[model samples]
Target: MTYKAVFFDIDGTLVNEEKEIPQDTIEAIAQLKESGIDVFIATGRAPYYFQHYAKPLGIDSFVSFNGSYVVYKGKVVHEHPIPEKTLELLESTALANNHPIVMQGAEAGYANYPTTRSIRSLPNRSMICVLRCPATEAATGRRRRCTKRCCIAKLTRNRCTRRPKLRSVT
Candidate 1:
């Protein structure tokens, strides 16, 4: 059996702790493309976070935001944004538990509450910029297409702060 396409994640799987692709991996990707296999990026990161890696890695198709958005050859083929009602539920849940969350739209993103050290340290370690916006801004904003909801679970004030844990509403 043969596969027609291959997908790669951006963070640890594709880039190292230094956030740089290894030379061997780059060569492998080149070989895969040269052999007629279609390569694509599948990442939970917002597209802009990994924008610089695209052309250098020779990838045009992507399934970003944990499959909420999909693009092929620079054209968006699919988009499944979370609804506003769900965002409300998530926001309330995170607030009650004192957990922080970062909601990301196609063009912009921000933290729902005041950030902790861990949250603030994330962007510096990588390219994921956590924009500082007013909390009144909706997670599923009507003005922008919301594609990613990243729940950040951390220990706050010696208590384990859980986040907006997802549950299937069957």
Candidate 2:
């Protein structure tokens, strides 16, 4: 059996723990493309972060944001944004839990904390909106700080209540 397309996860599959892509992986991808097989990336990370690696690796298609977004040949094929109500609930829960929240969007990301190396690694750091909690709202805006109650399990349970509808682009 032959596969027409191949998808690889960025973090550990294509890139190592040290964040370096092995030369063999790059060569293999090139060989696949030369042989008429399509190579793509499927990652939970925002698209911009992996863009620099895409072209060099001969990847033109992607499934990003844990499959919430999809792009093919520089064109967006699908997208899905979390509902406003759900986002609000998440923000409130995070605030109550004192957990720092980082919201990833299609083009950029938003964080409720200072810019860290991890956050800075995004393609466009300037696009990331820094949200300030009520305590620091005076200096920023109407953001709230995430407290200790912002457990991942609780947040996951809350978000699972409603699935975001996928928006297809022709």
Candidate 3:
């Protein structure tokens, strides 16, 4: 309770399993600030994801992507992305085995998979990108909590065309 800085995990600690960050959590962070304590976030979420989420709570420092990157007050303190050679090997293995893959780049990402793949495949790529961005970015966003069931539900619920039933001629 008297710690100088507190590092809260994004998933299941600050945010729900569905990646929903409750308003109460934000209030708790405010209380910490009022107590003169520095609050930080540590999560597997990418920096960009963590930023959006942590910003709401007024958090500035973060250990994101499982510590691959570190950010302090909106400035990048450190970064550690996977090597290009390793990325190539992983992509090759995935392609050879016909498994889905996502390559996280410095400024962009590449997702590779069969078009006939299932909904479960898309998020794997997004998670990879999340690991590359700052932690704050990963803890937030539509892609952060996208799962197979959630994706399917969204697809079903959000219909582009709402057409009325048509009568058939005899």
Better of 1 and 3 by lDDT: 1
Q: For candidate 3, which ten residues in a row score worst on lDDT?
A: 161-170
Question: What digit string (tens of lDDT, one per residue) describes model 1 on residues 61-99?
Answer: 988888778889888898876665786676667667867
lDDT of 1 at 17: 88
Q: How much does candidate 2 score in TM-score?
A: 0.64
Per-residue error at 51 for model 2, in Å?
1.7
Question: Which 10-residue window of candidate 2 scores lowest in summed lDDT?
Answer: 161-170
Candidate 1 local accuracy as lDDT? Answer: 0.61
Candidate 1 residue runs with Cα over 4 Å from true position:
88-101, 112-170
Question: Residue 43: error of model 1 in Å?
Answer: 2.2
TM-score of each predicted structure versus truth: 0.58, 0.64, 0.56
lDDT tens digits by residue: candidate 3, 1-110: 36788889977888987788887887888888898887889876555445557767788888776777777776878887665455546645765796666443322223
RMSD of each: 10.2, 9.1, 16.0
Model 2 over residues 49-124: C-alpha lDDT tens digits? Answer: 7887887776879998788889887788888877656676776676578666766665555555535785566665
What lDDT does the true structure give each of the candidates? 0.61, 0.64, 0.53
